[model samples]
Target: MGLFGKLFAGPQVDMAKSDANRKKMRELFNEVVENGQDYKLIFGFTEDIGWFNYGFVHGSKTKIGNLIVGWNDNSQTIVVVPTVPDLSGCGDATFYRRNEIRKAYQSKYPTDAFIIYPDRKGYIGINVCDWLEDEKLYVYVSQEEEVKEFTDFFLKRFQTK
Candidate 1:
């Protein structure tokens, strides 16, 4: 490979590293949540929202790293964790107990509250409403099955309420 080849090559995405990171994230989630095996794990990415110049921008799609969501139907709890590809940038997993969430819904359009994040595009937007001092947890997933799984879980739990 010459200098031209190096320059022409696009960003190198290490799928193996990404997979390992996802696994590590699941392990971390299990460590925090009780009866982790009972929870359904949904893999996705957390949008890194930021301000540029005078308005919000998409920034990098996966700059914040992978996102793993653990949902337990029996316990009525949800755990959200963000894991970096290298595992060093991992943060504390957020837990949403049964009584903690006041409401939840899916937003087709990105609201002002979530405008800073990436556009909804073709991804599914799940808004976990009124949890952790009114903080909103917005998760965007690209896969069709993942979208169905997440929406089904939340809609069944919160929509009727």
Candidate 2:
């Protein structure tokens, strides 16, 4: 765990919240994970404006909850999670890329271009972020073990099987 990770103690801090988010993430993950599913929003609210390539973009104000968005190239769809803390009150949480995320990770989860921060437990896990806006099929999973789980989930959602 990093300094902030130790300070935040993500694993102990919100295991319940994290577990709850994990369960929620799983549901959203499944939607995108399905082998036959087609174009659909996996999590947050979005329009069919078609911003990224032929794919659609999902941009919503994040909440305290965990959110994940991915493109299933085989299924030609998208998966999204809207995690906003104090939505109506505060501003939206920002994002960055993996390399970018790593920088922030080094800097302690700074919101930037297309990044995701796994709650706060060092390297125990990662907050999944769909980096479609900045780059195609580029996402960062804070949790390495969950990488494939996240990828497969997204593959099912945004790819054409």
Candidate 3:
């Protein structure tokens, strides 16, 4: 390859490493979901929406990381758990409830945001402007089947008609 080609070439990714990481994430997610039978478990990724130009321009969503959420109707609590691929292990879970959440909706842009349930604090991210008042959680699931399952289980229990 020429110098120009090397300079202009997009960032290269190690597919093998990415695949291994994905596999590890899946394994962790499965284990968490299996043990969380009492609560409705959903697998997905989270995003942080950034702001620029005094809120005039909304930057593209920045992927925070992947997670597996478990919510229990009886307890009226929701837990956001992380799925890390590294040897360091996963982080602690953040808990929320109906009172904390302001709104819940299925995002039209599935790739960006699938199911969003933003709480009173709204979207939490670095340099994020809370454009919407009282919005909370954000979840994005790529698979259609999993999305459907999550929607059915979550909305049915959490949201009121």
Candidate 4:
């Protein structure tokens, strides 16, 4: 490596690993389509509280894929993806409850940059441009009859189904 490259580079990110993770995220998203009416598309990783703490709560952007999957105890899985996919430079998941989870998971997974949060209400708000329109996505699973609700929502809103 060049002296400048060596000196200026902050910790080197494993591109291969990142790509694999991204691929998995994409595949899971496709799974949502294939499964149809069985899964809800959430916004953040809600597989577990710890994963949520790492990926969403901590504000760590993977730069891999803009999605994650979570399954409820009853075998209901929700695939979470962002419509405003580019969250590279600036991104944030705001909320008190999320903040609390992020703080607690910090020590548990100190070096871990991203962990998938499952089965929780996660939302992402984006302001594209002043002239353009703003978009917001809220990913969650309802306790009531959510299959039809989520399926219809995904199909009508995102046109992905």
If ranked by lDDT, best first, what sequence of candidates would result? 1, 3, 2, 4
Q: Cα lDDT of model 3 overall? A: 0.50
lDDT string, candidate 1, 1-161, tens digits: 99999999965545565456446656766776667777877754445465445355444332333556777777776676665434444466766665655444455555311111122333223333211111023222223454467667766764423
**Model 4, backbone clash pairs (residues 3+ apart or across chains), number:** 10
* Tens-digit per-residue lDDT, 1-161, candidate 4: 89999999865545564444344444545544444344433333222222225544553333322334322223423333332333222122222222133221111232312232322664322111101111123222121233345333423333211
Candidate 3 Cα outliers beyond 4 Å, as residue runs:
1-37, 49-61, 85-88, 109-119, 124-146
The predicted structure with the larger lDDT, 3 or 4, is: 3
Put down candidate 2 lDDT per residue, 59-140, tens digits, no spaces. Answer: 4433233345444455343334344321212123232223222222211243312223433542212344322222122221
What are the TM-scores, per candidate, against the unseen true structure?
0.53, 0.27, 0.48, 0.26
Scored against the true structure, residue 110 in model 1 reaches a CA lDDT of: 53
lDDT of 3 by residue, 1-161 (tens): 99999989865545565445445544554455544556655545566556556567655655456465666767776667675424134556666666766665444453434343455655421111112112134222223444565566556755533
Better of 2 and 4 by TM-score: 2
Screening candidate 1 with a backbone cut-off below 3 angstroms (N, C-alpha, C), the clashing residue pairs are none
Worst 10 residues of 1 by lDDT: 129-138
Locate the minimum summed-lDDT window of 10 residues in model 3: 126-135
Instruction: Name every residue pair that clashes in candidate 3.
Output: 117-137, 118-135, 118-136, 118-137, 119-135, 119-136, 122-135
lDDT of candidate 4 at residue 62, scale 0 to 100: 35
Off-target runs (Cα >4 Å) in candidate 1 are: 1-23, 54-65, 86-89, 111-144
Q: Residue 63's C-alpha lDDT in candidate 4?
A: 33
Candidate with best TM-score: 1
lDDT against true structure, model 4 = 0.32
